[model samples]
Target chain A: MIMQTIDLEADGLRALNATLHAQKDDTNQTSWEVVNAKGSHAIAVGLDAPIEVTVRGSTGYYCGGMNKQATINVQGSAGPGVGENMMSGTIVVEGDASQYAGATGHGGLLVVKGNASSRCGISMKGIDIVVHGNIGHMSAFMAQSGNLVVCGDAGDALGDSLYEARIFVRGEVKSLGADCIEKEMRPEHLEILRDLLERAGADAKPEEFRRYGSARQLYNFDVDNAGAY
Target chain B: MCGIVGLFLKDKSLEPKLGEMLTEMLVTMTDRGPDSAGIAVYGADAAGQGKLTVQSDDAERDFASLAEDLGTAIDAKVSLYQKDTHAVLVAPADKLDQMRQALRELRGNVRVMSAGDTIEIYKEVGLPKDVAARFEISKMGGSHGIGHTRMATESAVTTMGAHPFSTGPDQCLVHNGSLSNHNSLRRKLRREGIRIETENDTEVGAAYLTWKMQHGSTLGQALESSLEDLDGFFTFVVGTKDGFGVVRDPIACKPAVMAETDQYVAFGTEYRALANLPGIETARVWEPEPATVYFWNH
Candidate 1:
């Protein structure tokens, strides 16, 4: 199928996103290129079909938010809430992303080639996030189910109040949050890490990473762990 | 949410573009804060001269003959330059306090924004674009500056409630989050005799830094102490006569990005605010660490 190209500078955010929404359920119109984005907000939100979107420049808040089967690519840096609450499909950011990237996402594969700011993947459920560079504090906070792969460092209070989500980091961890701790990397975990790295197109080997998860100490209310509350 | 942008030029060649670049960065954050806006520019200083940036709801009544009135009251030369709702009063360096006191006695509605040899603050209750255009910010030149767009989570939405609050001479601060202990801290700082004009929580934060620096702490030390003293989720960007600093709370709930090159050091609430800056494509960009003070001095 022939791909459609939308210039954000000429068409504006309303027209460009309206066109994508109109073609959401049409499988034939599968490919799109968005040029001159220039930090516009809320691009390609609530897409429900398996389409391909490429954004040429940096975007503002909530870019590619609440997606369900479309693949979105941002060639430059992104503002806050990139791929927020995404249910399924893929979002790739070739440059750095601001705070709360992939926040509260349910299901999808989000790839960040550069650093992600504070609170990356907070409260994520079932989504798989792969970041090639460093991630900031409070990442994966209260996450229920998902996989977060970081090729570089993780900042203060990583995986705070985590629940069921798996975290893998290749570099130094500044600090860990309550009920979250380092666990031994088994063979199966290594295989999963390798798969995630390959899928995210990262160069680092899976063996260099360490695993972190909930310690299960704070799973239930107890007098012994009352101080943790 | 609030937004902050700071730029410190290390190379003299970029001085001419300081206001233009800062204005663009400030406008990009209009979504983060749409209620009010402000900017603080550190221009070249004249020897033995200081400037007082003052705002009045009735500029016509208060600023019509303010220079002459203040000049007579303080027994010195005072030149007033009006820009819409604000005005800059240049006076003898030694007579700044006297001039401030006289202005207070003369005009009850006048509020001093900043008084320094190099700093001139212009802020109002409007969008960033409108505020910048009102003050002709894009045409001004300086070595460094800081700008803020306020969402007004705390206090009333008045002209004095806007950000880039300057409580000390040549000192100003912009904040992105709320300060939980501002009421108690405001009283404490007031006891210490730091001049605070607004009920805005950000003003208390700025006054705290000014008090600390007055008590012999450096800008970096003052910011470091803020992590322990101030209670709340906050990201602070501060400007002094010759320095710029940034700090985030331990929780780091607010977003902040910094970029640096040999020519300059720039800060923004998001990377998009810094994307259009010169040498940004190759600049070293990263998120400031939690509870750590990052500062640069010329």
Candidate 2:
């Protein structure tokens, strides 16, 4: 595998993304290193190749967003909207993540080795997120379909107004939102949690976690509650 | 959206570089807000001396001989240092009130930016880099500082609308979001005799903190109360004589990132503003939680 080193400060973000987007499925440049990331937004975004990019330092907003078949790793903390709307790829953050991590994604895997800020995995669609540390408030709000696994504590209003999404928590939840309640973990959920934990390098056991999902109350449209709308 | 940057130094060795570091951080946020910019620096204080930062659109006519007139009116020795459209008057510490009153009577058009023993505020309607250059902020030295780049969501683009609004002696506030109930709150605060100068929402925020502090609440306590009192979104970074504090609203739609090291404590709307700070790679960085008050004092 050939390796490419791109200096972000010298090459510019547009040129770097263009280079990554130009690669085809059988391209020999499979590995890329980004130096001097320095909290710039939209690094390696909109990539459809199966290349691997490693950011050398902390990044600003939307790092590795809308990724497809790419494996991007951040060596430091990530700003807001990391891996947003990603499709069939993996993003790993060694440090903490800012707000709305993996928001509105259709399919992918995002692993945060450190804590995730508020609105983590909000409105997620089919993305699997594993946080080794705690998650902030309103995580997975209005989530249509996904699996959000937390190895640490969860903040307020976890998984509010969800639809068919599964949430697993290994620590105490501060408070649950309307219509979101804990459900009994079955064998299938345990199996899914075990696989996600192992893949994300989390040390917690699947049995130590609890599952929470929507109570399906908000989905009904009743004539009696029309004024509340 | 607006941008906010604050630096509070724990090590004395970093004191002289405070302004330079803060200027760099403020300029990096130009993309967040490009309409106006302002900075507040808490510099060294001399015994028995207080500093009054005043601004005037007509610097040539208003600032000249204004110090002599103020000194004569207050019957105290005074010295003036002018920068861009603002000037700092160093006068007797006990006579700050009289000087402020006398200046009001002497030059009705002059605006008092800040009045305290250690604080000097410089702000204007320009890009952050241009504003910092006009004030020579990089050359100035301070113990701690806070800066803002305004995008003008709630108010007009004017010198008075720029952030780092100083409502109390040695206290300044920079805001990133707007307040929904500022009009009603402004009326109430004015009924209680708090001075609010503009229709700007952030001025009301600064005045509210001043009102709370006047009623014997600490800065942290005042900030904690603001979460309940002030409505709409806000992420505020406040600078006082001895401390720097940050507070975000309950929703926390506005962003704020904080970094703390043994040498200093830094706050920015994003990590990009803090990328150039010394030892930042090793600093403990995280986003400030919602409706929480984080403060550091020297």
Candidate 3:
């Protein structure tokens, strides 16, 4: 594996993304390192190749957005919208994530080793997110389809107006949003949790977590359920 | 989308560099808000004197002998330090209210930017770089400060519309998000005798805190109540005589990143503003939670 180090400060964000986008499956530069990220926006966005990119420092908005077939690793914290609309990729944050992490992602695995801010996995679709620490309010809000696993506490109104998303939380939830309630964890969920925990490097037992999902009553417009709307 | 940057120095060694540090932080967020810029610096307080930072559209005519003229009117000794379109008048602390009254009568066009023992505010309608350069804010020294770059959503792009609205002595606030109920709140605060200047939403927020503090509430308590009373999205960074505070609305969609070292506590709308701070690599960086108040005092 070849490693290429690009100074984000000197090379600029456009050049860095262009270089990363130039890589093909057979490209020798399989691993790329971005230094001096310095909280700039839109780093490593819209990549189609199956290459691994590592960001050394913190980032600004929309890092690794619209990712496809790329494994991006942020050694530091990420700003809003990390791994947004990702399709078949893995993005790992060694530090915390700002709001809306993995929002509207289609298919991917996003691992946040530290705490995640509000709206984590919001409007998510088919993405699997594993958070090792606490998550802020309104996580998985209006989530269409996904698996959100939290190893620690969740903030207020978790999973409001959810849709077919499986949420497994090992710690306390401050409050649940409308149409969301606790569900019984079965054998398949435990197996999925175990596999995700192993892959995300989390140190928690699968059985310790509880499952949550939509009650599905508000799917259709009913006058009796008007208050929940 | 406005941008706010605040620095509260815990270490005295960083005092002289406060303006330089805040200037860099503020200018980095110029793209966030480019209509106007402002800064509030809390410098060293004199033993028995207060400084009033005043701005005038016609600085050359209005600020010429206004200090000497106001001193005679208020029966006190006053000294003036002029910076571009603004001037800082140092007078007796007790005579500040008299000075305020006298200045209003003396020059109808001059506006008091701020009045307090140590706090001096300078804001203007321009880009952050030009505004900071006009006031030479980078050359000023202080213990703590807050700066803002405005995008001008709520009100017109004018000098008064720029942020760092100081409704109380030694108190200033800069906001990132818009307030929905500021017009009504402005009327209420005006009825309660709080001097709110502009139609800008942030001025109402500043006046709201000033009113709360005047009603025997601490700055922390005032901010806590603001979460309940103030309607709309806001990420407010406030500065007092000896304190700095940060608070966001319940549905905090606006961005706020904070970094704390043993030396200082810093706030920025984005991490890029704080990226150049000293010891930031090892600083405890995090986002201020929604509906949470984080405050530090000297």
Per-residue lDDT, model 1, residue B45, is: 86
lDDT of 2 by residue, A51-71 (tens): 899999999999999999999
What local lDDT does model 3 show for residue B57?
88
User: Could you report the DockQ of all the candidates, in the order they appear?
Assistant: 0.45, 0.87, 0.89
Q: What is the TM-score of chain A in candidate 3?
A: 0.98
| lDDT against true structure, model 2 | 0.93
Candidate 1 collision pairs: A126-A145
lDDT of 2 by residue, B160-179 (tens): 99989996889899999999
* B1-298: candidate 1 lDDT, tens digit per residue: 9889999999999899899999999999898888899999999989999999999989999999899999999999999889999899999999999999999999988999999999999999989999999999998899999999999987999788898988578988999999999999999999999977778898889889989999999878888899999999899998889978889998887888888999999999877689789888788877788888888899
Over 4 Å off in model 1, which ranges?
A24-26
Per residue, candidate 1 scores C-alpha lDDT tens digits across A60-90 of: 8899999999999999888889999999999
lDDT (10s digit) by residue, model 3, range A52-149: 99999999899999998899999899999999888878999999999999999999899999999999999999999999999999999999997999
From the highest lDDT down, the ranking of the candidates is 3, 2, 1
Residue B7 in candidate 3 has what lDDT? 94
Q: What lDDT would each prediction earn against the true structure? A: 0.91, 0.93, 0.94
- Candidate 1 deviation (Cα RMSD): 2.2
Top DockQ hit = 3
For model 2, name the residue pairs that clash: none
Q: Candidate 3 regions off by >4 Å?
A: none
| Candidate 3 TM-score, true structure as reference | 0.99
